[model samples]
Target: MLSDTIAAISTALGEAAISVLRVSGPQALQVAAQAFKLPPKLTPRMAHLVHAMDGEGNTFDHGLLLHFQGPASYTGEDIIEFHGHGGVLVTQRLLERLLACGARAAEPGEFTQRAFLNGKMDLTQAEAVMDLIHAQSTLALRAANEQLGGAVGRVAQAMQQEIIPVLAHIEAYIDFPEEDISPETGAALLLRLDAVLGRAQKLISTSEQGRILRHGARTVISGEPNVGKSSLLNLLLGFERAIVSPMAGTTRDTIEEIIQVHGIPLRLVDTAGLRESTDDIERVGIQRTERELERADLVIEVVDASQPPSGVHRLSLPPAVASRRILVLNKPELGIHPGWSSEPAAIPLSCVTESGIEQLRDAIRAVIATAGPLAADHPIAINARHKAAFERCAARITAARAALQSAEAPEFIALEIREALQALGDVIGQVDVEQILDVIFSTFCIGK
Candidate 1:
């Protein structure tokens, strides 16, 4: 059992209507009683108005005190909440009084960590708490909520269940060498392995979309000078995020902003126009633009619809970048330039008139949709850590399937299956404690 109580200001610190200070552990009620004058009987999950005081018995403030008995609270311990006026000084004083009464300050994510330790939630649900806190778009919020509701946990558990029988069969074969395993049993084992492999691959496939939802997709807008690149950025952002100019090379640096298009968050980067320039600053900006292109998830290649297609040669982009490129013919309000429109892949758009912008949005949605449609029911692994775990799990399952196909010994197949199970366990955090706990919990807010 946990020995000491932990306390923290659960709400954002500042002046507001109310601020909540949370305390949990065995000593939680005793600590709260020391600082709060309450009725003789305190009901669990019920709030009572009381005068919060300090060690000297001087009243610091008046607030609502809520008591939650152990094994039922958020941290599965005796919990107390002091809901008081939302002044920074008042909240800090209350926390200080609680600390003085023998309650230690809760660390960043300590509450949620306690929840995980006490069986109130799993590692995935604990992570979703932070994800929900940082969610930038509606889709991200929904995904986080689903994850909190055990979407990823259920999938991980299912995959783990599938691997156990395979390991059992392999172990049985190992123990009973005299009992010749028939071809039928081996074939059935292979079939079972294949099914699990397919499931793991499907889960791994959602990683990209999950990542895109968690961290907005990095999209770089590129082209020669004055192709309405800034205009496109401004139009997409719905404001003047970049300087719009008729002159060449007005934007000497990359301007980046986040916007949600079709419920997909995009980290849109408006890069310096690609062109040979003698100006030192412009050259540096262009270099940065090139670097941005290298790391971009999507490249919106803007072209001047009023100008001829020959200017495309100025970009001199790499083939890899060219592969993920979307040709956008801007200034369509002026008129579509003859040769470029005929190139079927180019999307004609007019940032000046805001026409075809919806089509451009749809195209971006299509690119994201490559990972498969975003549905509320889909279980996605929403971060690099989860994605890496899923990928490793899939790789192990694939290796096991290959070993089975090559007629490897049951021992070898079992070893591979065991490794796969370990990998899946890491996903839901059933194993591997010290490896990822710090990294995962460090991202959380202090009060959480």
Candidate 2:
């Protein structure tokens, strides 16, 4: 149990109808009673109207004091919440009073961290708390909620359970080498390891899509000057995010914004038109555009449908980005013939009339769908840390299976299985807590 009591303003610091300050620890009730002038009897899980007072016994503010008895609350400890007036000064004063009563200031994410430390939640679920809070799109929120509901944890636990038996069987063989194991038993062990390996590999494959959903995919819009790149950007954003003009080279710098397309979050970067230019600023913008292209997960190559076929040569994209390119023929509203419509994988769209915009959105979703279709029910590893853990676990499992096939010593196979178990443990934070806890908790806000 944590010895120190912690307090923090749980709500945003601003004037509102009410602001909440949370306190949790062993002495939560005693500390709150010192600052809050509660009724003669305070009931656990009940809210009471109370007057907040300072050390001098001076009334500071009136609010609702809610008490939660230890071992049944959010942090599995005594918790108190003061929902007071939203004035910044008033909230700060209330927090100060709590501190004067022996409550220390809570660090960023310390509350949730405490919950994790107390076995209320695993590391993946703890991470989902922040993911749900910072989710930018509906899909992201669904994924986060699924994870918070113990989706990843359940899968990891299942893997651990499967590995434990194999490890035990190998250990038994190692201990009693005189009792030579039958060939059938060895083959059964290999089969079990292969099943777990297959599952781990499948989960590892979803990491890319999971990452894209958590942190929006990096999408760079590229094409020649005056090909409706800015217009398409504004259309996709549903607002005028980028400057649009008939003149060429209007966007001299990359403008980025996060937008959701078909429930998938896209970190959209509208880069300057790719063309040779005499203007120094335009050249710099072009150079930056090239750099952005190198890092792009998906590139929207805007081609002017109104231009002749010869104009296609102007879109000189690097061969490296060819696989991720989506050829878009913009300006269909111009009444100009789309001569390049027959081109493979070319989406003709009209930014002015908003025609074929749905197709563009569908195309963007298609690129992500290649990894796997995302459903609210599916569990995914949303962070690179989880992905790395899965990868490591899979590698060990694969190696163990290979060792079994090669008829390697039982001790050697057991070592591989132990390493695999350790890697899986890292996923649910059963191991290496000190190394990853700080990094994970640091992303959360103080109140969480």
Candidate with maximal lDDT: 2
Which residue segments of model 2 deviate by more than 4 Å? 176-184, 311-320, 431-448
Model 2 reaches what TM-score against the true structure?
Answer: 0.91
Q: Locate the minimum summed-lDDT window of 10 residues in model 2.
A: 437-446
How displaced is residue 436 in candidate 1, in Å? 25
Tens-place lDDT per residue, model 1, 1-448, is 3677899999997799999999999998889889999889999889899999888899989989899887998898899998999999989999999999999999899988888889888788899999889887788888998889988888887887767767765655575445543223667877877888788778777877888888888899989889889999999998898998899999999999999887788999999989889999999999999999888778899988888888534555576556567889888878886877567978889886788888899888877676555744474655677777777877887888888889898788878888888888877778543323332234222125
State each candidate's clash count. 0, 0
What's model 1's lDDT at 101? 93
- Candidate 1 matches the true fold with a TM-score of 0.90
lDDT of 2 at 94: 88
lDDT of each: 0.82, 0.83
TM for every model, in the order presented, reads: 0.90, 0.91
